[model samples]
Target: MSDRGRVPGQDYGVKMIPYEDLLKHEPLREFPEIDERTPATLLFTSGTTGPPKGGYHTHRGLVLHTLSTALAVKNPPVNASQDDVAMVLVPMYHVHAWGWPWSTMLNGHRKIVYPGRFDWGHILRVIHEEGVTFSAGVPTILYNLLMHPDSPKYDLSRLKFIVGGAALPEGLLKATQARGMTVISGYGLTETAPVLTIAYLRPEHRDLPAERRNEIYLRTGINIPLVQLRVVDEQDRDVPRDGKTIGEIVVRSPWLFREYIGDPEKTRNAWRNGWFHTGDAAVWYPDGYVKIADRLKDVIKSGGEWIPSLRLEDLISTHPGVNLVAVVGVPHEKWGERPVAIIVPKPGYEGRLTENDIKNHLMQFVEKGEIPKWWIPDKVIFVKELPLTSTGKIDKKVLRDQYKDALPK
Candidate 1:
């Protein structure tokens, strides 16, 4: 190992550790009786809408999560096994990079690429050079990759992506699908050993029409193995599986983090009612799939019905002139609250994007029964850019604060 001088953001210098030195350490010849409940690792939650929290997990939980996840990929679009190559892009500091480090090892080395510090150009090069077949990251990572001008230089048709960190919008999903790439959504948190669900289609839907099956890929998905998930209301009762009843998502998983470190009050609240409250508001589907519409605090309560802010954002994202978009609930006298859209138009469309364009685009979905008329935003506001959190998700808290009064009394 050689020292690499001083390292940024650290008090000490960086050193490269060699594999020969690592293997020189004493090895355990025989296994000893060990309790799987021992504390394994600590991870910090992304905290997109609030302050980040520390979460801890156990040995048993990690193994189970790794095993279950490996088994899950054995079927369907991501038929991962010993032959598949993996290039995990999720930040290592974030939920064990969605637990790929250990999970990938269990399936043996199928070629792994670690492009340190996320160079977009380098990432594209690695994918092509290493013959990378699979990868996972937040939606932003994928967006940047596809949006990169040099993206066309690389043949990415062989790659499959597992999106998480935030909801995957229909516009983004379809864009990747058009490229003949395998794109799917997964849902989890730092508190749940990180992955509780992935949007893999069921046996019945596998033979369905292509368009119909593709729609399933846009959902937050059904719970993974051993995960007991529920979309429930204030009374802690499961909401009707009508695919429109919005409710909080809570889960019971063996691999869930132990608790929030140094925060008892928050921990208690998180574990209330015998489940780990995910704070995600989603609709329950009859097919056992869960489509997350919005976070509870981010849901727009206009009139007596609930408006999913993410849904509006997704619709706006499809506009040709749009670069990015965010929807928030604004105060109103009659309805108590109303939806307001803040959009970032493409460079040429700046200040040219009109409120009517968005409303008219959304009406097409409404006319098709994709959404209700009341779900439409009351107003549209153009913006230079949408605020983003440290993790690159749209910072809705900032948006709410800035536009809370967008709708007048």
Candidate 2:
């Protein structure tokens, strides 16, 4: 170890060896024969919904997931090839960085660049300097990249982004497309080796109108190869594919976790009815794509009707003055829970972004029959920043707890 790399040995109760001294020892000749079904990794959830739960995966599961991910990227909208340079923006600890380390190597990608930390300006430089052509991360990462003041300094036309970890807001998707970068959406959970779906375009979709194509590109997407997915009602019956009826998403894939490590109760609840319950509310399209409405816990219950907060957040994000936004259900007397939006305004619009501005913005969409009138947020709170989880996703649980009483009776 270098002096700079050394830590206090006494505190850890272990002796530290310098790099030169460690190198003097002979390396092991024989390695253990590991089984494909052997326990591979134990990853924890991002804790966005609640307490983080452990997801235990196997070597076989991870390997199969890597192959599926490679296949998804190589197909349709992404068209990834060995000639394309790859950069994984997601942190390695987060769902094993969405399995890019294994997939990139398996696909024979020419070069792989790892941006050390997520400084937007620094990331922009890495993308431009290293000629990075492909990458994957959550929507928040993409938003930060585009919002940085120095982003225009780099030519990001060659970039391709695979957004996951959260729903891809339509406004953010359009902004990314405006930069000439191809942006696609994906959906998964930490328990499923995290790559269940990719919003790839089919051969027949080539000549579709731009508006319709954009709509499909931003959906949660169809099931990836070897994965069985369905949106089910409370009785575990499949939901109608009318695009208006919402149901819970359930899935079965070769790479899903076996259990929630040491928590059989949670494990049982997650694996109900012989399928892994995703607890995500979504609507299935006639074309077989799945569009997430909101998490089951995050849906706002107002006047005996459910309002998807993700829809509200997505529309609110389109507002020119809004930077980051989160919609949560707050306690209300007339309506059990009412929608409240917490917003981080753009640099020039601080203190100017008001409840009326957001309500008026959403009202336009409602009038266009794009969203329900009740889906509009009742209250809007301006803040400098929204709380983020350790994995860089919006910490809605914190927001819900902090502002549970924001609405009056």
Candidate No. with top lDDT: 2
Off by over 4 Å in 1: 1-34
TM-scores vs. true structure, each candidate: 0.87, 0.92
| Lowest lDDT 10-residue stretch of candidate 1 | 2-11
- Which regions of candidate 2 fall more than 4 Å away from where they truly are? 1-30
Candidate 1 residue-wise lDDT, 1-409, digit = tens: 2113211122122233444665778866895565677556656677677888876677789999999887776667787777777998877778888889888778775787787768898899998999888888887888778877888798889888889888887777877877778999899988998899999877888898878877788889889899999999988899999998888999998998657766778889889888999999999999899999998888888778788898888888888887777889888999988999998777689878899999999999999999998888899999877787766778888988888778776
Clashing pairs in 2: 1-18, 1-19
Q: Candidate 2, residue 390: CA error in Å? A: 0.7
lDDT by residue for model 2 (109-214), tens: 8999998887899999999989999998988899899989999888888898989998888888888888998998999999888999899998878789988888
Superposed on all Cα atoms, model 1 deviates from the true structure by an RMSD in Å of 6.4
